[model samples]
Target: MAEQKQTVSTDDGLILAPADEKQNAVASELEGSGISSPAEYEDLPDPDIGKTDAERAALDKALLWKIDLWLIPWLSLLYLLSFLDRTNIGNAKVANLEKSIGMVGRDYNNALTIFFISYAGAEPLTNILLKHWSPRYFFTGIIILWGIIMTLMGTIENQAGLLACRWFLGLAEAGLFPGVNYYLSCWYRRQELGFRAALFFSAAAMAGSFGGLLAAAISKMDGIGGYEGWRWIFILEGLATVFVGCFCYWMVFDFPDTARFLTADEKLRAMRRLRADNQTRATEEKISRRYVFQAVKDWKTWVYAVQYMGVLCPLYSFSLFLPTILVGMGYKGNRAQLMSVPPYAAAAAMTIFIGWFADRTKWRGYSNMAVSLMGCVGFAMLLGSSTPGVQYVGTFLGAMGIYPCVPNTLTWASNNVEGSLKRGVMVGIVVGWGNMNGVVSSNIYMPQDKPRYLTGHGIVFAYMFTCLFGGTMVMHFMLKRENRLRKSGQRDHWIEGKNEQEIRDLGDVRPDFIYTT
Candidate 1:
C-alpha cells in the first residue's frame, strides 16, 4: 500500500494540505463561493481557480517581474539617498569639516555616536507604526523632514549645532531601512525574498561609490556660493533628497491588498501565492499586544539580533570612515575620495551575486559565514601590511565581505518568521539593537590611532569572526535541530486538540510551520 499524506482542515478557510493538495483545495473553495466559471464572474474572474501548472508559473513570473519593476527601483533609489546622506559626513570629514566647525577631541565621533543613539531608539517605534500609517505618506513625510534637517546641517557653525542636526536626522532616517525590509517581506515569498531584499540593499554599496565620485566632483565647488565643499555636500544632497521625497508621494505603494498598480485578479493571485508560501498563515494587518509579546519572547529573534550586531559594527565603521582610511593610506584629499569608489563598486557587485546565490542554494547562514571569512581575510591583510596598494586591495575584500552578509541575514530573519506584526516587531528588534554597535564602530577608530588604526582593524576582524563562528553558526544549527524535531512529529502534540485560532496564535511555533534553514 502507498503511504498516506496527512492533512489538516481549518475553520479560518486555510487548508493545511501539501502543495498539490492545497491547489485543489483552493479551487474547491473558489467553486463553493458560487463563481466557478469565468462567465459567472466576468468582472473579477478567479485567476488561479482553473489554471494549469504552466499557466500558473507564467503568471507567477510575470507578477513577480511587475512587482520588481514597481517596487525595487524606487525603493533602491530612496535607500541610496538615505545612505548617501547618512555617510557623506565621512566625505565632509576628509574635506575638513572638523576644522571649519572648530570641532576637536572626539567631537566628530560624538556626532556619529549621537546619530546612532537616536537611530536605535526610534527604529522599533517607527516599524510598529508603519502599518498603521500609510507607507506612501509616511515615507514621503520622513524623507522630506530628514532632507530639510540635512540641508540645515550645512549652515551649522559649531559642534553643538552639528550634534543637534545629527540627532534629528537620525530620528527622521530611522524608518527607511527597517521599513523597507518589512515592506518587502509582505510582497515576496520566503524563497524569493533574499534576492529582492539584496537588490534593494545593494543601493547602500552603490551609494558609497556614488557618494565618493559625487563628493570628488562637488568638492571643486569650495567657496562657490560662499559655502565650503563640505557644506555643499550636505546642502546639495539634502535638496535632491527632498525632491525625491516629494516625488515618492506619487510613486510609493502600500501593501498588495490595496496596490493600485495590480488588477483585481492579479491582487488575488498575489495573495494566494503568498498564502501558499506562508503555509496558509493569514496576513495579519492589524497589530495587537499578543503578536508583540510573541515576537519579544522568541529565541530566534535574539539570535538573529546578535548575528546582525556582528555584521553592522564593521559595516558601519567602513562606511563612516573609508575616506579617512584612504587618506591615512597616503592618498591626497581628492584622491582619497576617488579611491573610496572602487571598493564599494566591487562590494555592490558581490552583494547582488551572493543574494541571488543564497536564494538559489537556500543556504543563508552558510553564505553569511563564508563572506564573513572573506572580511576576516581582508582585515587581516590590512593589519599585516603597511603597503598602500595591499591595503587598497584589503578594502575591496572587506567591502565584499560585510556588505553581502547584510541582505542574507535580513532575509533569513524575515523568511523564518510568520505573520506581519510579528515579523515587523522582530525586524525592529533585530535591526534596532544591531545599529547600537555603531557606537563601538564610532569610537574604535579614534584620531590618535590613525596611521594604522590597529584597534579598529583588530576589533572589526573579531566582530566578523563572531558573525562566522558565533551567532550565525549557533542559530543555523539550532534551527536545523528544530526542523528535525518537527519532521519527527515531536511538535504535533501542541496542536493536537487546538482549534484554528489557538493554533494560529502559536504563530511560528505551530507544528505545520517549518523553518527555513
Candidate 2:
C-alpha cells in the first residue's frame, strides 16, 4: 500500500526486513551463532571478520577514494562560491567599492565581522537539521540560497546595503562545513577522512586562485551600463553557484540507502563493510539535542576546538589578507590579482600531494602535524625576508603550509566524535569557534601597516606556536591511546557496540579509527 521503506543496518548487511521479516532475520542470525540474543553471548565478532590491519587499512583507503569523488567537486564548488562572495569585496575595493559606497577605513572589515557573527550563530543548528534532511537537498538548497544572496549583494548602493547583504550571506552559508562533515561521516571511516577532506577543503585555494583571475578580468567591465566590474564578480559567481546547486540536487546521493548508483546487494555489502570498519549508523538514533548538550561538555570537544582555534588565528588571517598583502609589492592592480594566483596554486599543489600521502599512510594527526610545521616554516620565512624574490617564494610556501591544516583539523576533530548528531554539533562548534578568530584577524594588518605586516606576522607566529604545541600534544595523545588499546585488546567493543559515550570516554578504543598516518 505504501512505498515500503527499504533499509539496512551495519549489524547484518542484508536488507532489514519489516516486522514480518524479523523472524527470518533472527533465524539467519541464529543459524551461525547458535545463540538467540547476541547480547547474551557477548556477540563476539566473526573470525573471518573484515581485513587485517593492513587489509582493512586498504579498504579504508578505497572507501576514502569513493567519498572523495562524491565530496570534492560538490564541497569545493560550494565553498568557492561562498568564499568568493565573502572576500570578493577585497577585490571590489580594487574596483572602487569604498568610493562607490562612501565607505571609509575599517567599515569593510566591520562588515566581514558581521558576517561571521551570523555565521557563527547559525552553525550549531546545522547538526540537527542535517539529520532529518537529505544532505543532498539540504546542502544544495543552502548553497543556492547563499548564491541568491550573493547576487543580491552586487546591487548594494550604500554601506548599509552592502553590510546587510554580507550579513545575510553569512547566515545562509553557515550550515555548510557542519553539514558536509555529517555527510562525509555517512560514508567515510575516521582514518580516511582527512585526505578526502583536504581534497574538498583545497577547493578554497582554487577559489582564491581562480577568484583573483576572474575578478581581475571582471573588473575591466567597470564602466559598462553603470555597473562596476566588482559587482559582476558577485553576479556571475553567484549565478554559477545556483546552477551547480540545482545540478547537485539531481546528482548527489543522499546516503548509502538512497544512492541509486549501488545495487541492493551492493548496499548490503557497503553496510557490512562499514560495520566491520567499526562505524555504527549515525542516523538511526533519535534527534540530537540531548546528545549535543552532553557532547558540548566533553573534554575532547574543548581539546579539538582549541587545537583548531590555534590554527585559525594564523590561517584565516593569512587567507583573508593574502591578496591585499600582494598588492603592496608594487604590482599593478591586475598584476596583484594575478600574483595572488601563484601562491594559492602552490598551496593547491601541496594540499593534493600531502593529502594523498596522508590517506595512503592512514595517519590523520601526524599528517596534519607535519603540514602545520611546513606552514609554520613557510610563514616564518616570508616574515623574515623583504627581497621580492624571497618574499614571493615565502608567500608560496606560507600558503602551502597554512591552508592544508584546515581540512585536516576538521577531519581530526570529526573522526574522534561518534554519532551523527554529536559529530555534527561538535564540527559546527569547532568551526564556529574558529570564525571568532576572524574578528581578531580583521584589523591585525593595519591600513598604515604594510610591507612588513609586523603586528600580523607576530600574531601568526604566536598562533603557529600554539598549533605546534597543541597539535603535537594531541597527536601523541591519540597515538598513545591507540597503542594502549592494541596492547589491552579491547578493540572488539569499539567495532560493534560503543557509540558516543564509549568513544568520548575511551579514546583508546578507536578500533578502526586509525590515526591518519
Candidate number of the best TM-score: 1
Residue range 1-517, candidate 1, lDDT tens digits:
2122334333221224444565555664433331112232343345676766567667878998999999999999999999999999999998889999999999999999999999988888777778888788889999999999999999999999999999999999999999999889888878789999999999999999999999988888999989999999999999999999989988998888789999887887777656655523233456678778888899999999999999999999999999988888999899999999999999999999999998887888888888888998999999999999999999999999999988889899998888888898899989999899988988999899988888899999998897544888999899889876665567677877788668766767876676767
Index of the highest-lDDT prediction: 1
The TM-score of predicted model 1 comes to 0.92
Model 2: per-residue Cα lDDT over 1-517, one tens digit each: 2212222232222222344555654654434322222342233343324435555445544544665676668677777777777777777776677788798888877877788788878887776776778777788778889889988888988989988988888888888877876677767655556667777777878878888899899988887878878788878888888888778776677776566766554454455444444455564567746777767786666777777777777766766777777776666687888888988888887887776676566566676677777777766776788776777787877788777777777776766665666777788788888777777777787677787786787787777667544665775576668644543445544445556555543432344333322
TM-score per candidate = 0.92, 0.82
Q: After superposition, how far is residue 494 of candidate 2 from its true place, in Å?
A: 13
Q: For model 2, what is the C-alpha lDDT against the true structure? A: 0.68
Residue 232 of candidate 2: its Cα lDDT? Answer: 85
All models: lDDT? 0.84, 0.68
Give lDDT: candidate 1, residue 334.
90
Off by over 4 Å in 1: 1-45, 279-284
